[model samples]
Target: MSDNYSIARYLISQLRPGLQLGETVLSPDGKVLLYAGTILTEKHIEKLSYYNCEGVRVRELQSGVGMGFDSNQQRKRGNAEPEELIVSHEYYEADMAATVSEQETEFAGIYGNVVKDLKRCFTIVRLEKHLDCELLQSIVDALLTLSERGIGATALLHTATRSEDYLFHHSVNVGILANIIGNLSGAFKPSQQRNLILAGILHDIGKLEIPVHVLYKKGSLDEDELHMVRQHPAIAFKFFRRFKEIPESVRLGVLQHHERDDGSGYPLQTAGAKNHPIAKVLGIADVYDAMTSKKVYGEEVSPFAALDTIQADSFSGKFSPKYSTPFLHELCQTLIGRYVTLNDGSTGQLVFWNRSGKETCLIRFSDGQVIDIMNQNKLKVIKLVC
Candidate 1:
């Protein structure tokens, strides 16, 4: 392969069958160069003996049987037979011949700044209610600006991570995702969008008062511990009540985010007729984030799976049908064209969105192969690889 070859050009090559190796496979500096060719047998290794290349190595590979180079390694190391051989280049660049380098750079930079601003906003909220309302409003304005420009705010928010401040990051993610859902459903105006964002940012503020051990406990909560957990909504409600100037809509969203439309939620079991519209939106966003986030007890579910679960429950009368159908459909559409990593360690692009079945997507690999997630039983979507 040439240095000028674009990453998109190589995507198809990675899907090719047999042992195909590049000279600069996985190199950091991106200066390594090598040829790509198939390995017929161990005897064929001698053919390259005349080509003196330093740091040369041979590895067995299989195609269509698994996902990427990493998947091949795992299968091969686990007593699986070698079905192909792949050569790699000496160096692999991070950007790897991207078509729109400038655009990518700008997008990454903006995303980074947004994450930073979200963290700052949470910190101010934690310290006191003295945060500059205008500053908080400005952050919301910035997000809307990027969203209007066609950036997937939900995906961008999903990609950001925080190790030490899990609550803050989680809250921001919930807000961004809720705002995206509201915008997609055509239910929110500019003012409502800002309110939703603010509500999302503060939805779990009550959790701050809980003991860290209880919040981060690895095992299931006992009855007494669960009692404490249930008090968070009330704690949040009381805290917000102290701020009389805060909009009632924002406060109500924080208090009622956990309330279900079927009257099964905690504190107040408000049914569809009783639950506020903002609260319903917040509830959907809250559970979606929780189920998709890594926790002590279990790994996060795939975004597609989470959406499926919500849709299933909605149809069964567990959630409000008014908001659930459109929200799930829009979310699935937003995820089309994104790349994801499967539970089996395969990397592919999500090319289709199907809302009717357990398998909801068509994931295409580099080798002109497509995995019908709706039909494949062995593989399931695990997460969106940002």
Candidate 2:
């Protein structure tokens, strides 16, 4: 094993179950094979070997020691093939090593309860083709109350480590995000805000109509499969049309959530003003959660990365600038004073932003060293440490 700060690179033969990755593992084809924070398993090892992967970088123990293997013994293995090293810039999270805060614990509890409720609600909708409006309303109300208490994207990201079902958790998170965007936009009244949250909750309901195998497929989808997947928005729109209790704006948001302002979106290819305001907010919230939430098929990115992507898209006319601007600004302010781990394996507290460049920020490390992470090519903020 070769050590770089708290990271150790291990050959496939040296990998063992329970070892957590410190960076992403990609295939020769440039597709992500395993994400950072993934605990190694026998299956994962087999997959890595099947792909002819060279090595993986794993987290060192909190005591600054390598986990268990002897580096000399690993090097002496005669049959082991030479591994071509690859550089990774992705952030890593070792929740086991970081200290959890009261807010994280609280969010986890709330997330667990809401996910269970959402699962049950989805099951009922699937069997009866009827949404239990009161039950879903209660769930959204609970999420709104939590939103009122003030929770940030970082808290939501860390709390997701305990969740297993991506769909249910994504639904609840989008609801919360939509509500936050609504509150920040100041364009919606109380009733409309509740409806927008409901819209977010039901935004991906059409995905349930898709086959499980297709919905959770490991890699790329064929053109036919992609076509089927894009039909989700239309399916959801038709289903919601049955209920008069749902507002027209809420239904429109569900249908057009995937419809980008630049006409790059699917289904109807609707552009700019053709999309509903609620849909516009839902679109931003949807992408943000999808990028920041841990999933079975993809890795969750840091909030800073997600914000950067959104800002770029907003500038390119894909997302509405009005909502995206304030949302990004608020999220940056929320990240201040929070703990973060950088690509260099150093943990620090985020102090402030330069407010000039998207990636420029100040981080104060444990040794009282404050870094301007501005033009440092190797230094990147990787993950939020609770």
After superposition on all C-alphas, the RMSD of every candidate to the true structure, in Å, is 12.0, 15.2
Q: On a 0 to 100 scale, what is the lDDT of residue 354 in model 1?
A: 61
Alpha-carbon TM-score of each model against the true structure:
0.70, 0.72
Candidate achieving the largest lDDT: 2
**Candidate 1 regions with alpha-carbon error over 4 angstroms:** 1-135, 149-151, 294-298, 357-360
Candidate 1 achieves a global lDDT of: 0.59
Once model 2 is optimally superposed onto the true structure by TM-score, how far is the C-alpha of residue 333 displaced, in angstroms?
0.6
Each model's total of backbone clashes: 22, 0
